[model samples]
Target: MAALTKDSMFERHIEDVEKDIVSVTSGETRPAAGIDSEVANFFASQSQGPIEIDEATDRRLRWMIHKRVLLVMVVTYFAQTLDKGTINFASIMGIVEDTHLVGQQYSWLTTCVYLAILAWEFPTNRLIQRLPIGKYLSFNIAAWGAVLACTAACKNFTGLIIVRTLLGIFECVCQPAFVFLSTMWYRREEQALVIGAFYSMNGFQQCVGGLIAYGVAQIEGQVLKNWQILFTMLGCITFVWGIFVGFWLPDSPIRATCFSPEDRLLMAERVRKNETGIQNKEFKWYQVREALSDPVVWSVTLISFTNGMPTGGLGAFSNLIIKAFGFTTLQTYLLAIAQGAIIMTFLFSAAYLSKRYNQKLLLAIIYTLPNIIGTVVFLTVPTRSDTKVGLLISFYLTMAFGAVSVLNLAVMSNNVAGRTKQVVASSLVFIAWAVGNAVGPQVFRANDAPRYIKAFIAHMVVYALQVVVLFFLRLYLMRLNVLKRRAAALRESTANGEDRDEHLAHNHAFDDLTDRENPDFRYTY
Candidate 1:
């Protein structure tokens, strides 16, 4: 933002300096989207100031958004989860035996998807920023669905890798899009639950997808293998759903047809408190530079990597791990239902804690406690028939990491600002996620199968480091908040009358400033 003189800081009105703020928004296209374009489109306008909305109206508007917006996000994420999980579910159904995936070949099948995601993250995020999100995402989803269907035709490891890589490239758009949506449609305070509700589909899909996989396995046909049937069924369903979402979902609040022009303004007003600008087509290199150097971005990147390691391992290997305990293939699928329930429970608890408390990063640490205990048991326990159930419970406890991942999404979204900066930070964290996931499956080598002792030991160290990173992330945010408050105090001491109103105004909210540039932006974690 523009540097103000001491006399201008508290003595002059912000409206007077509207003529003088080219310094503040030098590279930015000011008031991008909902605050500016929508106001122009609607004919009924709101001059930028404090948008006083009553509690009941705000509550009603939020639910109205939840019904249309949140539902679309949840279903889209659920489809993406189920589609990505085809290989995981297929593992127990004989894809390995059919494709002759000996040694670490199976692990590579899982590893390649994330490798594709890692390669596509930066380029894909740039597209997400520049294109119409709903249409672009729907096209990708539809394309991935067709690619996933081709997994049914793969006769060997190389063919499957080609399709799975395509699957990863297309599905990579879902996550960053959802994170951006949470910021666009909701206030900062409302983001946690919205993110949790959609992301919890990671678990929910396990419940539904497991049942679907089991039934498909029972199909009797030599013309198509059970795994082939499963892949084709999942891919076709996703393709149909993706086409539907293109028509049903809106690109942005400014573009949402479900709400009236007046309601759109209300929707715009609802999220203005977030200080993070809604949408800006202009890509500022400085903000990208800011995200690269920003401690908050790197802190979350490390946290995301440590968390992603175990998550990716489990994503591909959970059923295989269960099967190693001597359970039949069908039994393993049935047992994963219980694991899904455990994940759902942990996710909801984390969401509740985030909504009720202000300590988001601390809650991420606390949620990891169970996973740590779980890892200890997984590492030390004997893998006897009598100890099977105990080991399985330990597996479930490790699912508490899901809570940490979802909570981190809310924290990162809450903290980052500026369009390019948010995209850069999000892409960096997901790239770390892909790297962690790619490395994750490599640890579960075929040599260490039945009971991957070394992998569990590695998990213990990684999970511990995850907690330490989260703690330091919390401290860094708290320190940043302190500095912001110190600056606010100095600015406040000289303020009076219209100066107070000018200082308090959210006029800078849509100015496309990075979090550091916006004086009013507060760190939540």
Candidate 2:
């Protein structure tokens, strides 16, 4: 016989492989490996063995888990926010006056924190996948808390800079670790609310930190200044919380002590259904590539970058902005408490709506709109005018979108599959945030103190960009949803029909079903 052509031989091999895959997928023939048996065996072995769980017991158990986990997440995140927000609190305590730091040097503290975060986020996220996450996270929290306490003892600008740098290094693990932990515990539908509840710590810190700082500043004849006392108190509280979390928090569903064997299995199965599969044990470069290649990842990056700039500005200098309203230091702190309250309300509302209606993108746009308006008002309204205070209040209140940033995180978690991919997605999302944050504080120059016109303008432009980015992201996601639905329908049709499988097998053709095969999968865009 004449020599077979390469194309002809390749086509024959593809036809054979397709026939096998079609047979396996379509139930046209039993797979020689017995997939059902394997699945059953895998579950039986991995679980602690089955036990019946009544609905009431299941509900109670789940509630306990949620309560425990949420407590840890909320406290950890609250501490994280408090530590980061101390700059704002410190500003009022005469930190600038004491340090005599000026201009860009002042900006460097904020910039260095974010720069540290950007450098460490990816590697830390990856480490979380391999290490004992809860334990690692708790240790990190405690370490940062110790550093935060040291902040209260700083004598000059150099001391403050050193503490802030150390604070950033230890604090880097909390954001991504908390996010990954949430993914482990909650289903996709429940994620936004849980994430929101955890993220409400940001607002809660503002409220509580203001109250506490007011009290701490009153200490008489202390060895430390008021700023030092502020750091000490916050740091001690965080350290205590860290100890509690270290001993108490469960690392994963498989390791949870509160859940019975059957409940654990149910939890696993429930998550599997939502995730499209169980979490992967091993990291893979291909999985990272898959996550990085998604358009949604980039869309979220852009949205986060834009939204983060205003959020970062508010975080770094909210107190300073409020001080411009001619409020006394105590008044500024109290007003911050009110602003924190407004932020909490909006954060919870947005989160609830996003989860209830699956409107992640829409909620983002809605939250961004308020901030955009607030920024415009702050930029245009005369600084000496009373209306400027209202505009400033609006600016703080509109920052409810910071909670939506956590919602964006939940979206990314839901969209990416495999531990490696999750790590990559989390890193990129946080790096975008760090970048925006690093740049934001620079806009608030010392010269622009009472009327930060340039800073307000910068915020206005960024918020507008946020709106635009969110719009495009929503469109991209909508398109992806259409494609996914069409693909799912085709898969269903293929499963149900004989001729289609035969054709597919003979033709050696199949639509990309990787998204379906991977349960923890969705289009990032």
Candidate 3:
């Protein structure tokens, strides 16, 4: 009789806990009580026999994921960057004379791509949410590859703008896809390193791009200008590469064909601890509101804007600046290889240290400090041959901002939750990026030419301002974490001896809840 009574009490307690966790009222799920049926079903399905992922299995999975996914990401980013950066190389290869570009028309060439991005980002983001990401990205890549090929044939400013606009529309898919896909496959701890490795492709692309352009520059007496030959060759290569992305890349873990059904389940279960759901098709208006209202999103967007000014200025005119320092055209291209190396070193190091030390936000601030020093030197140093070496060193150090950029992207990815909200936040950040890049080139007029003292001063001010913003963003996230922890504590205290399930308390990691709605969703700094 005593044993029966105790068993009845235990069963009753379990039922009460489940009731608290799985509650729904009037077709709407309350954040505090339980997750939606979709999330609850996913957890029940994946939790077959204790979700134990062994170390060896984890290593194997990571290796496969990198081989399958990371390879595509790096190659796609490299091609996109190489194609976009060709304009800088082309400037030295005689595009200025060939196209009859006058005054700010050359600057407008760079601005057109970003302007297109700004115009299309939100609509593209909506498409990303609704469509199969892998297929969508692959199609866009192939489409852009064709546009890039067409760029080789552009004869005038209008022709260039038309193609560059198409390039921007197609290329906008890359970053957001990578961000969402990283969240899909990896844990929060692993995301930074993976994102860093992929984003670092920009640096590698710079190196290879310089080499390719240098090779093209050696050609003479051909029907086409060397710049045209360079574009045509790179565009053809990218077009072929796009086919590979379409066929090989998997969209999400659940949809991945490389793994078995059992392995796929494990893959989905693996990221359940991320407290951000894998994929949610429904676009909730409240989540969109939450994202726009969040201070972190706006702060990150502002940071992107400020940082992008220098990025755009340097990217568009770095070769011109270096040539102004008295290096020959070929010499400028070769020296750019060195700049790429510096970028690669800093970006990889920052990501590694952040992963090793768990200081994502701190490393972002630290990386920007070098850019401040670099800009100050550039502003003060006379544009004379005697001081060229100092200016070159400053230029090299300024590439440290590359690290800051990678960290910022990782920070945004790490903090935001909910598929719709993440998409919205990413769109806004990239929109800011577009605006910054567009504004950056306008600062460097034909009149400013070689030294561009005004441009460097702008960079210096923005770098310093960026540091301040990062500090405040960190403080804001920490405050949110503290508040959430307190709420969690209070909720636990009132449990009345009901057993608290770890997964239940986590509110189902795949539950389509905004970060604000899920009390268990703590902000990662």
Q: What TM-score does each of the candidates earn?
A: 0.90, 0.84, 0.90
Candidate 1 residue-wise lDDT, 188-275, digit = tens: 8888888888888988988988899989888895689999998898889889988988988888888888788778778888888899
Candidates 1 and 2, the one with greater lDDT: 1
Q: Rate the local accuracy (lDDT) of all candidates.
A: 0.83, 0.70, 0.81
Clashing pairs in 1: none
Clashes found in each candidate (C-alpha, N, C closer than 3 A): 0, 7, 0
* Model 2 ranges with Cα > 4 A deviation: 1-42, 46-58, 276-278, 490-525
> Sorted on lDDT, highest at the top, how do the candidates line up?
1, 3, 2
Pitting candidate 1 against candidate 3, the one with the higher lDDT is 1
**Model 3 compared with the native: what TM-score?**
0.90
Question: Which runs of model 3 end up more than 4 angstroms from their true locations?
Answer: 1-50, 490-507
| Candidate 3, 1-525: lDDT as tens digits | 999998798567445423322332122355432344544565577545437689998888888888888888888888888888889999989988998899999898889989999999998888887888888988998888889889878889899999989999999888888888888888888888878887787788779889988889999899999988988888888888888888899878877887887877778777777878788777777778768877789988989898887888889989999999988887888899988988899989998998898888899998988898888888888878799988999988888877887888888888888778898999999999999998989899789888898888888788878989999888767655544544444333321222234334454467776666565565777
